[model samples]
Target: MEAAHGTSHFLRDGVVMLGFALGFVLLFRRLGLGATLGYLVAGVVIGPQVLGLIGDAESMIGFAELGIVLLLFIVGLELAPARLWAMKREILGLGLVQVALCGIALTAAIGLATNFSWAAAVALGMPLALSSTAQVLPMLQSAGRLKTPFGERAFSILLFQDLSIIAMITVVAALSRNPADAGGPPGWQLALMTLAAIAGLIIAGRFLVRPLFRLIGGLGEREMFIVAALFTIAACAGTMELLGLSTALGAFLAGVMLADTPYRHELETDVEPFRSILLGLFFLAVGMMLDLQAIADRPVFVAVAAIGLIAIKASVIGGIAMIIGMGWRNALALGLLLSQGGEFGFVMFAQAQAGLLISPEAASLFGAVVTLSMASTPFLMMLTAPLRRAAQSTEQREEPNNDGAGALVIGYGRFGQTVAQMLMLSDIRVTLIDIDTEMIDVAGTFGSKVYFGDGTRIDLLRQAGAADAEALLFCLDGAQLDAGVLGAVREAFPRPKIFVRAFDRRTLIDLRDAPHDFAVREVMESAVTMARAALEMLGENLQDIDAAEQEYRRNDDERLDAQRAAGDYGAAREMVISHQTELAARARLRIPGRPTNRTGAGR
Candidate 1:
């Protein structure tokens, strides 16, 4: 292909890809379904074997691979090594049970029925062992099951499952035929290469990448920070590819090493846009690969496969959850949540195809199964909530707290402490619940009433006056905690004016739309304090200060409106800063008094 011809082809390919992305984004937003599914649907629409609008998934797959790297990086950044180890009972014990037992049992049955070789069946089973991270996490988060004991256990197992995906690539590579070469590197060499790639990533991460990011960050160029993140991922992956190991493994290693770095969160924030695009493309590509024709030819086979896969997986997971001390409701929820095949299954299937370990038809069949499983998860999660409500209604007899006339606060962190202290001063009577032992101790020392307990625990809620409390406040920062506490409170006292704290704009939107009577940002108090200081420094008399502050708030509302219009965070931050500065100047010009002393402004 000539260079110009190649360039033209690339541009054409890019346009097709962008069209798929745009369509999915709109569909996802409109349907209240996740964008991941939309991407898959788009892939099916444009895929060559289907509409033939987009032929050859090679280029798109490459970008989608980048998405996988970013996704794992974000996961690693959140999952610290110590925390992973702390959840070993779940990650190792329960996780191994979920993956290995399910894999072996499912494979044995499939192999026996289809009369396929054990190897091919094993290959199929390996993919089935994986559960969709894209599907499961979002559902759990939306349903408030994320921080329940079941949620933590499920998350830990999923984390291990994610890491195991990279390992699966290596396993498939090793198992593949060498063909004419018949002289590929020995097993030891391959193992050494994998180990060396990992060690190199750790060394580079600790001694190199962090410092480079710090230097790039100092340049005060956000674009530079973004570039630095991309470079780190690509370079690390390329290095591992050169070492005859999986690029995904190398990228994951780099992420794990940087998990504890201060810049990890910033890196995650910076890479989100790219991650979304890449992940969307990946799902779209997977959708394109679905064997629609095969399903058409063997509709019965596909239907039985889908139904059988879900039923078997759900049953196995429920058994495991029950064994692990999950309540019946939680056990059922866990089973439903994990009954789907995850994206990593596609990764495994790709490696299998490249290795010639599985026939093309088999690969396509497996892909179809995985995609269907993922798509069903949202509906499954929706079902879980209604079922849980029914279960709760049938089980509970009477209100736990007949004497709770006070306000109930879940979480005794900074936000919770402030609210409790204010309530105490106002003599409104408050009951505080927290999972943090230290916070409970501190609250008691300060002569504040608090209980050390998980807010998600129904018994704990009862002890904290859930029934009689006039209001409920959730000051927890984690989404899982917030949702669980909210659900528990709602179930216990359906009529309370539930107040909650949100950590970000998305959370705020969710909270505002939620069935809460009041929703406030965790930082709103700090914002008020800063506003007071700014107004005092601007030489405004108390009377004029109040008016200016109101105007400032009004201006902020307008600024936020502009920000959502722009659809870019960098622009939004700039607009906010500009508005604050401009309003301060305008307020100062209108104020009657001279500038206040720094002490008076509490500077």
Candidate 2:
């Protein structure tokens, strides 16, 4: 009876939490605030400090941290190996400088303003150098800028911040005031173990993980994909935890391993819901743990310190961005966008407390400071929209799927499959797109990579390489092609030779004056082949059959031309071959003709 009542309590709490999240998130977003803020605000309202409805936020944080881990994994999926390598300069140069300078400056501020020793300041300040990836990434994505160059720059900095966690932890551990932590691994030993673990994960991803996913893909079990994706994250995260490394880092590595493959979109789709819910829960837990009483006791100090941290980090980062040749506007926007304390700050503070460097109250106070700084970022960006807009004009737009392909075939059905394979046979690089997930799964079984999306969407096509492709093949099965879409595609991506599939003679006629370079009636060639075979079966001479076929094609072309001009399927009825003319043709070919009614129009 007790266990059942406990379950009922959990169920009730779940309802209340999610319901609050739904209401507040919608309201906050309506007020131009982001969902993270909404979730945080919602948690605060229901938390022990307020309504006292939800308790034990400290325990909730461990589970909610998976949201962060999954988020890193998703971010890693966006960074293919080549893309990561391409940002090496930004990651090492700009990112390193931002973290180092920000950490130092914040450390000094803490030391000067507080009673804490230099060791505690270093332990606390370095982690604050990182920004909230969970909050900022969604904002960038919602605004459709996550793939832009400015976004890339922001991402590079964040990646380095994530990479710096290990070093930060090492520093905190080495400065440990606790005798228990003193016997823990040294910095050098930890670094070596991190490297070894990373190598092992890479090797496993290549040899074991990828093959497992492939087997699952071959089986075409979508539910199993969700299962496999979750397992991958869990297994990798568990390994890192076992080795005293960041579980988020392990999930990130797993995502990177699979990023270059065709299954990324599928994995992303499957794992996204979990990431969203858990991440919201993470922010909610963060709010519940804000220690409002601690902040209320020293409100002015918390508020001032939070503002100072934002200013220092923004100035340092903006200055670095400018030094790296970003426009001043973009530089400033980038600075403000990343000018908040990160989720990792809480973890680092807890670590400091564990090392006996700071008290729980000190950690809670700093955590409140971080939260307030984070709360201010949305408003800052909203007020600074002009700078971002002006700067974005000078930057390159997103190229999400620029795979250096020469042809983009926009359907993977029978027709698109043949068209794509022929291009491949001639050694042309091609990117294939279709809206069918089942087909994509099956295609993976045969080593064919088909992206899932509506190819008719110009944005999707552009991402699939339409701009750079030498040819655009619209091989949709039905009369899905039209003049307006073709014309729009031609104007938007004039570099590609647009070829469309016409479902019938009528569809061909409808598109006769469209902007496409070519259109083939889906059944025209097969009909011609069938006519030739029937003539051969009748023992007609090859020479005469060829002449008859040419004559028939000439009439068909003339009638199709007339129909296109008139924009009517029934137009040019007089141009079709009559029974008398057919009889004359039979006489000329020396074949008997039986009197019969003429067939209707093939269309």
Candidate 3:
């Protein structure tokens, strides 16, 4: 009875936490404050300091730290080894310089600001040099700028910060005044262990993890992939824990090993939800653990420290970015975006407490500082919106040249090439536009001039002579077009005939409401040809194969028409599945002297 009662209590806590989180997140998000702050506020409200609804914020935090580890893993998956190497300059230059400068600068500031010695200040301050990865990354992703150069640079610095966590730990351990830390290995030993662990994890990833994923993939078990992805993170993180190293780094390394693998997208899809929930939980726990009494006692100190931290980091980072040749506006935006003290600050502060570098009260004070700094970011961004927009407008992207061309091909990939060549065969003047710079360079070498710019952008299309061109063929790969884009294009320049290359059947169905002269399924023709060849290889007559092909095409068209009008596949599913038997019956009826099975046919 007691065990059942405990389970109910546990369920109650879960319900309260999630419900409060949802409500607060919705409110904060509606207010344009972002969900991180909402989660933090909810945590505080539900915590012991307020309503006392939740239990053991510290233990909740320990479990929630997995969110950080998973987030690093996903970030690592975005950077393949080759890409990481390509970013060596920014990682080492901007990242390393920014971290070193901020650490030293903050250390001095903290040392002078409070009663702590130089060592304690260093321990507390180094963590503040790191910004909230959990906050910044989601913002970049939501803005669809994660693949942009600015985002890449921001991520490079964050990646380096994650890598530097071990070094920070070592610095803290080396400066320890506690008896417990006295028995730990020296900094040099820790460094060697980190190197060995990294090497082993990489080897295991190639030998063990990839093979494990391959086996699960061949079995076609998506559930197993989820299991495998989580297991990989746990295994790496657990290994790092055993070695007294950073588990987040371990998970990150695991992700990096599989970064270039075919399963990267699948792994990201599987692990992202867990990362999000845990990350939110992490922020909540951080909030819950924030000492309200401590903040109330010295609100001025907390406010000043938080503001100073933001100011110092932003100035230092912005200066470095400008020195590295970024425009002042972009530099300022980047700095403000990363000004908040990171989630890892809590971990470092805990380390400081364990090392006897700072008291729990001091740690809580700095934690509050970090939290306050974080809360200021959305406001900072909102204030800088105009500057960022102006900077983006002047960014150096190749513009399309106006040529009195009859046809403009948007993509220069395999699909676009065929379309362009076919059009040129008719002696029509074709203007080629492609977003891929490398492909354009290669095409130039082959004496083909393809302009570089986003073809989907309405302004770019207009500049590329979309109005004057006889045909505007969207041959870009994937489902880049939607009803919104198609509608805009149609409304903007209705004179040119529009053709779209759909990635699949779903793409075609999705844009059925949009106005377009024609939609070409990227693979439909080739697939039909392959099916015809297969039939021939199976000893089926060409005449019968043609009939079969014609029947399938007719049925497909009927299904598409039905699906388009109904806005669902339910009404069209039977048209596809039931067509086989009908086709066979029709074929038999066409045979000479075949018996008619249909009603009133034999008469």
Candidate 4:
């Protein structure tokens, strides 16, 4: 009876929490406010201070912390060692400076403005120095700006912040230690323990993990693979906890270790759902932690503190961005996007309160300020959209040189570069335009003349000689940008023969409906090359392999046309199967040594 009652309580709480989460997320997403804001709002409404739907904020927070661990794990998986190394300048330089400056400035200001001890001020400053990875990454991704220069720098800074959490937690723990417990553990002993823990993690990851995964993978069971991944994360996290280390750091290290493994994609797919849900719960828990009564008691002070925090953080970030050579608009956007006190602030404050490092009243007031500042992130980013647009518009434009040469390439990334290089090798002069300034700069180092501007802008396209160009190539990576440029080119000057590089099958289909002389899949040549190599390894002659490949290409093109004409993928797939069967039968007949089973073998 007791077990049944406990189960019922669990179910009820889960349902209520999920209900509010889904409702708010959907509502906010529909209103273009984003799901992060929605989750936070939902938590506020259902929290103890409001409707009291969930009475156990502590329990919820305990579970929600797993979300942070998994979130960092995914981040680590996505960022390989080499990639991190490439961003070391930004991560180590900008990130360290940002944290140190913010921490010192905030610490001094807080200590002077309040009656808090220096230890308490330092603790508060540490959390304030960090920004929200969970909030900012998604917002930038949704805006399709993750590959842009500003986005890359923002991500590097956030990565540093995530790594700094380990050090910050250690500092807080040391500060919170009672002076009477001086005989506990020596500083060197603690340092040795930390080093031992790290060495053990590295050894286990290098030796034990790969073999275990290999054994599980040999079973050919995807479910077992997922189980293995979860077990790995749990074991690593639990071990770190037992060692008095950060579980998030352990999880992140585990992810980095497995990043180069073949099963990385599968692990990501399996863990993505859990990470997203748990992360949302983490956000919701943060909202529930806000002290509404405290805010009501001192509304003016709370409001002022929140505003002050944003201003201080933004100014510091903006200054750093400018120093790093970012345009004023992008610097401002970066500042606004990361001005908030992060979710970690709550964790640190809660720990401080529990350890008696900070008074409850002070924690309550600071918690309210952090929550308010976080809740304003989406609004602040939205407010900066105009500045970004104006900056884009003010970019330098080049006049169209009607006398230049062979082709006007719309994008100059990896894909476009290949096409441009092939043209140049044939002694054809190519003019390139790309929005990525970095790509343009690198291309210039190799003697490639490329303009840095949005290809979708008709004015930019015209200035690049769309009217007199021999051919126009739309090799832009972004799907929306590709389609936009295609439309703009067709409308402005339809004389130039247009060629588009389709990103995928869907893009190919979409481009097929556009006015293009040719539409090529980005990977079509690579796939053909791979197939040819496979056929060669199978002892097939070049003549036969070439014939087979040609036939296959012709059939695939016909199938694509049929699919487009019918506007039905199902029929197209069936047609492809039938065509494959016919081709196989014909091949057997053509081979003199191969037996044709037209009748019974015995007969």
- Model 1 per-residue lDDT tens digits across residues 1-603: 699998998898789878877977687757667777778888888887778988777666776788888887777676666567668788888888888877777788779878667767777787787787877777566655555555677797788788777666666766775473267786456767787778778888889987776565545466776788788888887888887677777677767876755455456666667877788778887777677897788777766777777888888888988887766886787787788888878777777776667888878887888788777776776667777665445442333242334787787887777787898798776767665545555666777645444555555565445666777887786664344456656767786688877786555543432467776667766887788888678654677767667766776666655555665444456545454566565665575434447458631
User: lDDT score, residue 76, model 4?
Assistant: 68
Candidates sorted by lDDT, descending order?
3, 2, 4, 1
lDDT of each: 0.71, 0.84, 0.84, 0.77
Alpha-carbon lDDT of model 2: 0.84
Distance from true location, Cα of 341 in model 1, Å? 1.0
- Tens-digit lDDT string for candidate 3 (27-116): 998888889999999999999999999968998999999998998898778776656788899888889999999999999999987889
Residues 166-188 of candidate 2: C-alpha lDDT, one tens digit per residue: 68866775677777746778756
Model 3 error, position 464 (Å): 27
Off by over 4 Å in 4: 179-183, 186-188, 394-603
Please provide TM-scores, in order, for all candidate models, with all chains considered together: 0.64, 0.75, 0.70, 0.68
Native-to-model Cα distance after best TM-score fit, residue 283 in candidate 3, in Å:
0.5
